[model samples]
Target chain A: MTSPTVFAAVGEVGKDFFKERTTDTLPCQSTDKLFCWDWARENFDRYETPLRQHVELVLISVAIGFAIAFALALLSHRHRWLRPPFLLGTGVLYTIPSIAFFFLLLPLTGRGRDTAIIALSAYTLQIIYRNTIIGLDNVSKSAVEAARGIGMTDRQILWKVEIPLARPEIFAGLQIATVSTVAIATLATFARGGGLGEPIFGGELGIDFKTNIIIAGGLAVLLAAAFGLLLLWLQRLVTPWRRVETE
Target chain B: MSGLLSQLPFASIDGAIEFIFEPQYSNVTGGNKVGGIDKVVELTINQLQVTVISLAIALAVALPFALYLGHKHKFETLAIAFGNAGRGIPELALIAFMAAAIGVGLLNVAIALAVLGIPPILTNTFVGIHQVDRAAVDAARGMGMTEFEILRKVEIPLAIPTLMGGIRGATIAIVATATIAPLAGYETLGDFIINENVYGENGVLAGAILVALLALALELALAGIQRLLTSPGLKPRPA
Candidate 1:
């Protein structure tokens, strides 16, 4: 994916960029110096790399998780026994601690962004799967019967009737998973994958309290705004009928 | 299931208990021993303490905000947006932020978890209260009940199921996520798992399994609580 490429390129360049531009170029000794537009401009080259990396991590992980969830939802619908086991397994996976899950995978997978993506994707499975099932189930039984009465095949019924009906719920689930993926992707910093978390974690380790606070708070606001907007856009796109229905 | 349990290192409940309490005596068939049993027990208790305390604080603080939001049309949009934003931020980042600001410890962990925990509780409380039969609320008001009395007598009871459901969901999420607390140097069951992983020990699997079992047990207990809380009054009325 372009996400992984962007992430890798960013990480490779970030440290060098930070060292060159930020090492001895301080206008003030106070932590507030870091927040100045001049300081930002000087450090912008350094910051761009990690920002790209963070975005890529969120995007790639959400994409992978969404694909897996879609496939699982489809298969579970196809087979009865599979549904229960899949639900049970994903439920347990969802409950597993993300940090622990990442650490567990780290030894086997070795440290990097991929481990974080895999762990977050596993966590996404439960919410997405449950919502998908509910969405599919909510497709009116009468509609299915009518489709069959009209001699439509099962696939046709699914494509034309079931999917459209289920899209809202499914999209709601996706919105949730997307936001969660973005948030959790920040933790990928622990494995040296560089994100906004890099600044947060770096500040923590360096005992630079001000930097840590600023980065963490700034990231939170940014994530909230970005995800909030994305969710609104998604709701508008996938559930336009909702507006119509309410009207 | 019993056979599967038997194959596990600490199969029996008593055996698990003993293993947790007295790690020195516990046989180490695996290469990894992250810490003694007492450490695991202490960590588990610590995590539980953090989770419960934070949840209580969240509910306490959020309930009134929820009630206020439920009553005020102007605040509803703001409340919903705040809740959504709250849910959107990653728990880890919040924890990291808290740890960074306050220094790493239990309080920081609790604050972070509480922040993450509030939106669900608040939103659910507002939703549950709002979903109450409007007529019932009106009747209470007509009967000369004060606003507070109406809220207490009519709205809260109707909202209990949904409020409990939100609490249940939040509890599960918190318990599972609390393992992250260890990263900030606060001990939890995650300590064993993370430590085992770092040192190349087979114990990571066992630690993971134990944490998973702990989560399952908590979930089952909460489900039972939900059922009890929501069941008795849920029967249909006669036509």
Candidate 2:
């Protein structure tokens, strides 16, 4: 965690470790300055690990959330009666804020990535589960009838026909979940989950550092966009029929 | 297992309950009394204040623009993109950035949060209004209704569910983010969570409990409001 010394020629930003400065002031030293290029260039390396960690947190949380929500959605689909209760249960989980969520789980889960993952994943449940149900529900009656005419069993019809038909809406849910997770995972630093939030929330400089906030915040936004587009692309690839419909 | 559980300060759930209902001595401030129902009420009020203000601002700004756009059926892509972009914004960063760059105050925090509130309202309102049955709109027009009358009497009523969904989303986002408004120097329920040094473990748990309850309450209240606003004709019937 040592400061970078490579930018010695430009300014001594990395060298000063919160020590009281003398009369000399760099643009980065001034808190009022919107952004300082020199400071950002020097401190660019600081965000690398946190950025990767942020990605990991978002991906893992969404993956876990999708798995659980998918299973629940399937169970609800079969029983039908379980839908309302499952929806209400996940809705309650979704309503709780992550900051509060972190502390709520502190006693049982303790602090760290596991607690962060649990909370973050829990947040995704309502959106994912609801969307999956909606998608499955929207599967055309005639398509199911046609499949049944071919003597396909209930399990086969669900896996082969309904799921494939529901792919776009399922992907839509995943897109929203993944994108939002990117933003929320930044709060994981509160649980010591360590993401880009570490810097934004007073990691090296301080929370008040505009430069750090912009960098970390910007990275999160970019991460969300990248994930969003990737999901959109995957949705298109998986559901080629959707493209034909648009055309 | 019992010993380890006992060692954790927040393990005893009653300690958190007591923290909410009764003030406790804080060693960090040289044995000062802290927390209690009064403190919780104050912080919750602060949180609600910010959330209400932000949602109002978001509604005031987004409602008109989205309604106009939806009525016109223009800028569909822009509305959708705006909603998507809004979700992409990290709440922590927005609050911290506003505090650091914009300077901290209730107004600043509200504005920061309203930024979070706008897109959902805009996109949902737009979609809601845009998706209203064209036949109803035309039938209203054929009944000698003006364009404005048609929108007011027909479009808005049909769009209430979607519009209210947006409002509910905005409320949830605003209230959740308000929990962290203390970071922007606006003391809300988050003060207990953020300043753990002062409030300690029980206080943190208390804050979490209060926040969860507050969110649930707000959601339920909004759901009730949505039901009231929805047109009678649009209500779902039993199969």
Cα lDDT tens digits, model 2, A182-213, are: 98888888888999888877486778877788
DockQ, 0 to 1 scale, candidate 2: 0.48
Worst 10 contiguous positions by lDDT, candidate 1 chain B: B9-18
Cα lDDT over the full model 1 = 0.67
What candidate 1 gets wrong by more than 4 Å, as runs, is A1-39, A75-85, A106-110, A140-150, A191-194, A202-208, A220-224, B1-34, B71-76, B135-154, B182-185, B190-213, B233-239
lDDT of 2 at A131: 94
**DockQ per candidate:** 0.23, 0.48
What TM-score does each of the candidates earn? 0.75, 0.93
lDDT by residue for model 2 (B188-236), tens = 9999888888988888888888999999999999999998888888899
Clashes by residue pair, model 2 = none
Positional deviation of residue B138's Cα in model 1 after best superposition, in angstroms:
5.7
Q: Estimate, for each residue in A1-247, the C-alpha lDDT of model 1 and write its tens digit.
A: 0112333434543453455455554553243222334455555455566677777877777778778988899888878679988888887777666665665554356457787778878988887888888999999999999999999998999889898889887887877777766676666765556666666654333423334435554664586568658767877787677889888
Candidate 1 i-RMS: 12.4
